[model samples]
Target: MNEKLHCIGCGTEIQTENPQEPGYAPVSSLEKEDIICKRCFRLKNYNELQPVSLTDDDFLRILNGLGTQKGLIVKIVDIFDFNGSWLPGLHRFVGSNPVLLIANKVDLLPKSVNKNKVINWIKQEAKNLGLKPIDVLLVSAHKGSGMTEAMEAIEHYRRGEDVYVVGCTNVGKSTFINRIIKTATGTGDIITTSHFPGTTLDMIEIPLDDKKAIFDTPGIINHHQMAHYLDPSELKFIMPKKEIKPKTFQLNAGQTLFVGALARFDFIQGQRAAFTVHIANDLDIHRTKLEKADELYANHRGELLAPPSEKYIDQLPRLVRHEFSIKEAKTDIVFSGLGWITIQDTNCVIAAYAPEGVEVQVRPSLI
Candidate 1:
């Protein structure tokens, strides 16, 4: 049993013990010519992922190494959770390498949403966050939309140099790389794709025609993600699978809308206006008076409100409120990884809430 041996599926060093950890394989499987760890095995066959995480130190070491290497950085992000999936300060870590931003999961957005507007917004947000990317493109890695364009962009920007694909956990970095493998080598599923964070344990490289390579780096887990605060079973309810149908609620001041038990949006001060919710359609939304919101949530957070489902309710931190005064028209109140609510009317006061560590902020309407 050589501890140095890595899983062919995820590149984590193989170990016989600790099934709960990465690279866990049965001793019986050691004789096989190509052995994937238990995690990848389940993902490949059952399409079910068991959640696992890596230490920040582990990812920091990987990212810091990028600064010393020469390559084009291909940064993937979830369009539905752009801020949550973003690797903050990535520009400083990649040295002078040009970053090509790939915003994945475009298929989950509403059909009415303008693609160019989304691209522009992403570019502005990248600049605001100190990342000046060479280009920004949107694609649905799962559905293959804009993937050809994405591939072309990578080829053009890399310019015979190595390419490094990086992003926070659950942003479809692995899926994006799998698409490349399928196209380049006519082989697929070389890497594991899962809902779990830190699916890729180590850097896996794919050789280009010119002997250059594209490296798939391990996903850095963002603590502020709503995924970290919910049970895996609840993840499906929050992570949208199909195109979203914008649900608009007409409300006056002093009304509250609960997006499952994961987030809350309150119209504190505004004229009667339309509040359009852009979230996973499977997740339930409950509207109530602002005054009764506190009492309702306190009484039925895991039941009537749903999601944490009582069994895992204690795992979530207490909700923390973030207030905003919307001066700009069509402002969106984003609940990090969960989703967002758009306010079309200006001069409105709003308050959003999420689990203590999760982020809630306002931005220009993405649609």
Candidate 2:
């Protein structure tokens, strides 16, 4: 029998079949001195990320081991998808280690958005979620923004101990580590990065000093994210690449807005109000009468209202409604991972709808 080979990059056991699966390398590449899976190859050369599915058992095992390890836990979360990317109850798993929360993708927010306010919002959310980090800082790993401050903060907090970077899949943990590598050794893109989730399969350790190193752990998949239900091609529509240009729609009661057939916002019984949508600028949001919503979705889900685009409409889950009463003057209805709709008017009754498994909730505005 042939001895099993593994990808030098992601550490997945190599296989020649099924390009979609983890650890798939081309048959021709088998004889090469250094072999990497096809997924890592595309990520390195093209800067494209391919999606992979790993069992929950695999991620839980890694997370369960964090408490036993003596290191600083540097947790990264997507600023845009704050709640969706959060690893709930992580404070318990870290034991006595201090956590430094690094919020990635800050560049995606509008320039008008206040940085201090965002940081304060994150700190509050972290406390509410049972994580009391040593510090909360924002960074954009893709744009190389705030990396210097992040590095300084990490070094200061780690105190000669090792660092473990953890976050859910697609939170840019790999890209952030790549930035650290480039800054430290001038190496370019050592870890594979893509827009899709589950890019890293194993814990990759980078030496911080002779005695300590930073470990990039596999991203624990957040099952509640909207990204799981859509096809790879459709991800571009939801994942914002540029600063979000807040889109505000003036609507009266009984109006329905569709966020690419992935989420729905209805002004059920509200006075005239302006709902500012903070989503990927490229995503289409169509407004129609509430009475016509059912007919319109039934007719146009895969077409006019997309991203369960015609290709994957059948696989998409049914929309589940979660209604909220707007008590605060400035409130956000978050459609976890997709984006949010901020309603600045009080005493309004509204309903947010998202795919059955996807999460939708109300919170104070981030901006």
Candidate 3:
């Protein structure tokens, strides 16, 4: 028929070649009764993960167009990886549109953590970035936590206007919207959800009412995310699906901890102190002497350290060091998309190492 077809799951145009790209289906599959791209097909049937390929310019173009459209912006962010999930210059693209910050994956936080404190911290961080959200709500899209509050906030702020949901890739926007759809319509149909970036290539709209609609925008591609570097099987080891049980290590000077061979935390000049790590429970962590850390990593990265899988080892960037000296309050050394370590020690000198371009930030402790 030579007719153009789009995947109903994510709205990406279907093609036969380029399996790495979005909306790719086999020629045989295209001739079938129900046409879905390989990404959607695997996600729906086998529950497999695939990377989404979209350029930074493409995401910026989609976001820039929102400035001219009249709608409420619902910015969904992964609570576990806040910095990695946040789109840079979000305020500039929205052009004064009221933003409702929806922090997804709140269920992943430790049970001992206070929600109010986390919300305040998120607000402060947004304020520092010049993003003044009209409201902030924490929700676990995967578990249906806080979906009602999110809906109420959207309804209240949207005021019968269109609602635009946006965020960086792997932020769980599709899952969040799917929950909203099911909640509002009592339908079991779900939009495709995957750990990979660029899952949504075009906008998918759900009618909220005759006068209003909620739009799910494609996730903005951020090159700085660790997800871009790891294989799909490795993602489960790093991406926390449950509450993170804090792992504390008592370290003396000249010690190092390897976070799955992807990051290193060195106790350069710290006194005998405790460092609390918050990362996926399944990921392996190894401790060794700082002097021999490099030798160990080079010798047995994929075997002992892991997740720079053998296939991706050559493509992984060299570890770049970021040194920090903490003299005051507790601080979190965040490795974007990986997790963070919180340390509270006076006159402590430490250093964090991660693949080049993956952000390693030092921020005031949220706990």
Candidate 4:
């Protein structure tokens, strides 16, 4: 019989019998110092599943403290799901402090798109959203790509300052911090990085020797995120990952598309607009004519449409619609959690949908 221990990642006590939760370890490995077992280890090292949710109040309390400190604020963003991973009201929370934005998951973009261009675009986009970040670095937190550069940036700006890593849940925030831990310090720290979702429920500070330290806060779980309503099996089908090969569908007015039950997009006006979808590479996307979409969705939501499965179906609200005209330069009809439909710089009427209570807003297109 194997004894159990708490997981190094989430500090959850383990039973070893149930492999479903974090911290599952055997008696031999249970007492190990860095006892993060296979489950948490995979989630931390690879981009594996460790779904945990946090509340808004808990998230805001952590942010409010950042302004009082004198450290570099490293704001992280998901390159694959940029819109979904950005925290709203972040600018107000950080105050006048200098901010460095790191667009994480760079490995997930199109090969043709220049990496520098994407970083620049994110920098500009951040400003338009009222956040004047001091610098922006692109990195693939999963593969340790550009992590050194990000560290250099953090070190240069840190100036013996406290560091705050900010990102919405699932933007590789924990992974990036772990990288920061390994490179900046070494592999000897006791409280190391392993993914178990928002590991730092409160602000967990790791000292940079005696003078400086990195403060990691619990990831702010967007109440609007699909992850909250989704099971582990469902998220893989909905979220996009690497180099989003934009799925394009020519839609006549009154056509509907479902982004794995996370969002519904309907073409309401204009001459057959080109609907460009950006999502995780793994998720299944289904489309049908508006007249039949509702019926199809009802019949095949869990089987075909997926994500918000029948188990969580009743939890999902009736999809609400927001009608808007793309009057600005290349506006993206941002859907919470799923991804966005890039509307080219043209005037067109579009209707967007998500489960009720999740706020959806359009921003300048990234591409």
Candidate 2 structure, TM-score to reference: 0.89
| TM-scores for every predicted model | 0.89, 0.89, 0.88, 0.76
lDDT of 4: 0.70
Q: Candidate 1's error at 179, in angstroms?
A: 0.7
Off by over 4 Å in 4: 1-57, 114-117, 190-204, 327-331
Per-residue error (Å), model 2, residue 160: 0.8
Which tens-of-lDDT digit does each residue in 1-367 have in candidate 2?
1988988777778999877667888899999988998867865665444545556776666677788788899999998888888878788889899999999999988887889988988898899889898999999999999999999998999998988888888899868977786676454354432121233365555667655877767667888777778787888889999999999999999999999889999999978998999999889999999999999999999999987788889888999999888878789898888888999888999999999988787778877
Q: Which prediction has more favorable lDDT, 3 or 4?
A: 3
Model 3 off-target regions past 4 Å? Answer: 1-13, 18-20, 32-53, 188-201
**How do the residues 140-160 of candidate 4 rate in per-residue lDDT, one tens digit apiece?**
988888988888888788877
Per-residue alpha-carbon lDDT of candidate 1 for residues 45-160, written as tens digits (9 for 90 to 100): 64434444567877777677788778899999998888888888788899988999999999988988888888888889899899999999999999999999999999999988
Candidate 3 TM-score to native: 0.88
By summed lDDT, which 10 consecutive residues of candidate 3 come out lowest? 190-199
What RMSD does each model have against the real structure?
Answer: 4.2, 4.1, 4.4, 5.4
**RMSD over all Cα atoms, model 3:** 4.4
Clashing pairs in 1: none
